[model samples]
Target: MRRLFCLIVLYLLIGGAPVVAADWSLAAYWAKNSPDRMIDILRGLNPEMRSSYLNAMALNYRFHQGRRIHWEVEAQLVRHHGMQDHWESNAVLVARWMDFPWDRWLDTRFAFGQGFSYAWEVPPLEPRSDPEDGESAQLLNYLLMELEFAPPAPDSQWSGMIRLHHRSGVFGTFSGVEGGSNFIGLGVRYRF
Candidate 1:
């Protein structure tokens, strides 16, 4: 399983290299930990938060552009501070929605992506959901959901973004682990 994961990542990077030279984007965010499960947090059930925090920067390359749907791959580097101090990295494939009815007022895009996440150490907050069965690993599955907004001008290259950064075991697929950790983040994106 691990070998397959490595090969998939290599293929993405190598196959997308040519497109990387054409146009690329940069994104950065400041994220804070949420103690509850991702869905519960999204449903607004959590009131308390964890002490963990991170700042992440990602370089994105868009290889396929359609009329309304676009495809991209991004590589990220992260620095966790506050309650957890560690380095993390990931590479993801993203599908973005670029068409909206209100484009003249505010250009909006929503994106969802999934890939692999690696930690320099076992992240302190990523305790296994079922403590009796599993433990956190230095590598796990990564997922992200982002909403971005920019000005109406076609020449605009800057935007504001909000995202949910998640690392999970995919129901014990990565290891014996289950649900992992989540962070709610605010950030910016620049396209060039």
Candidate 2:
């Protein structure tokens, strides 16, 4: 708990160095659980589907808007069901890339976020993915990678997204737990 607080304070200290045109957004997504690790999933390995699913909604505050890069903080409320039933929440700081060469053809964006995730209860399926580590925590490190696109119009407010939702212990940083869970999610976003 102390470590998490310290990290958040440090991140806020750095982020507070600048304030720009702030904006807000709302997003929602539905994700299915995968039996593969985040690395393998990103490497194009086929996902082994599980019955677990999560529906999530997020509110994003973009605090900085640079020409090529933007910074945002996001809060998510997620509901989990299927193989298990519970609730999870996440707070993340995201970095978004705004300028793509082919924007005139099809507008595209990529964003990466890192932060913390807290579950209503320790997830049972998490330890099964890493039997050797056999430890799961209610609170863990969270991360996401999202790619979204819209029409060629620069003023478009709606876009579709495919995101990778991941949670991990970061080599025992949380509770001497080495592994966690991953979800392949599809969603949409509306920026206002």
Candidate 3:
């Protein structure tokens, strides 16, 4: 009888298993004001590289339709006139929240989490008594909203999305209006 019960349990587990493949998505984004503030801070150091101010980024993510957790990363490459160049990158941990009512034909999600980042600011052509440029690793926070084409489901029946995110100042060191940098972007998600 014990052997029969063990066999039954194994059968149930095998029968309920579904084979699924991991999927990925890529998004192109353009935004203003973000990292703009950082540029604002950097400009004070060297006013020459003002026009070279450009902000563009790509977002990448992997998802498991069976689980609601996802990971994301963003990089901002900005050029300045001095030896001190800067790259801001963050690795984010995101969780999709329950759907809520929006307008017609759309669903909403709230994803909030934090990440670890590396930041480097180059020094001026000529060093001052105090060089404001340095490298640091810090903590970051993100609060985002995703608006998708279809209703929320375990497998997302059919959906595309626009994700908006804001990050906090590297851990608790710098203070800004609540929420980190702000991003509003669009993309699609397909699940098998």
Among all candidates shown, the one with the greatest TM-score: 2
Ranking by TM-score: 2, 1, 3
Better of 1 and 3 by lDDT: 1
Residue by residue across 26-139, what tens digits does model 3's lDDT show? Answer: 433333233333334334642222222213343545342212233333333322222334455546655445335552445554454455443344212212223342222233
Candidate 1 weakest ten by summed lDDT: 12-21
Q: Tell me model 3's lDDT, rounded to 2 decimals.
A: 0.41
Residue 185 lDDT (model 1): 93
Model 2 global lDDT (CA atoms, 0 to 1): 0.88
* TM-scores of all candidate predictions against the true structure: 0.86, 0.87, 0.42
lDDT of 1 by residue, 1-192 (tens): 999999876555343323435668999999999878888877885535778899999999888765566788999999999988999999999988888999999999999999999999998788845576467898899999999999999989999999999999888899867869999999999999
Q: lDDT for model 1, please.
A: 0.87
Q: Ten consecutive residues with minimal summed lDDT in candidate 3?
A: 122-131
Q: Give per-residue CA lDDT, model 2, range 1-192, as digits (tens).
A: 999999876564344445545588999999999978888899875778899999999999988765567789999999999987999999999998877899998899999999999999998778854468868899999999999989988679999999999988987888988888889999999988
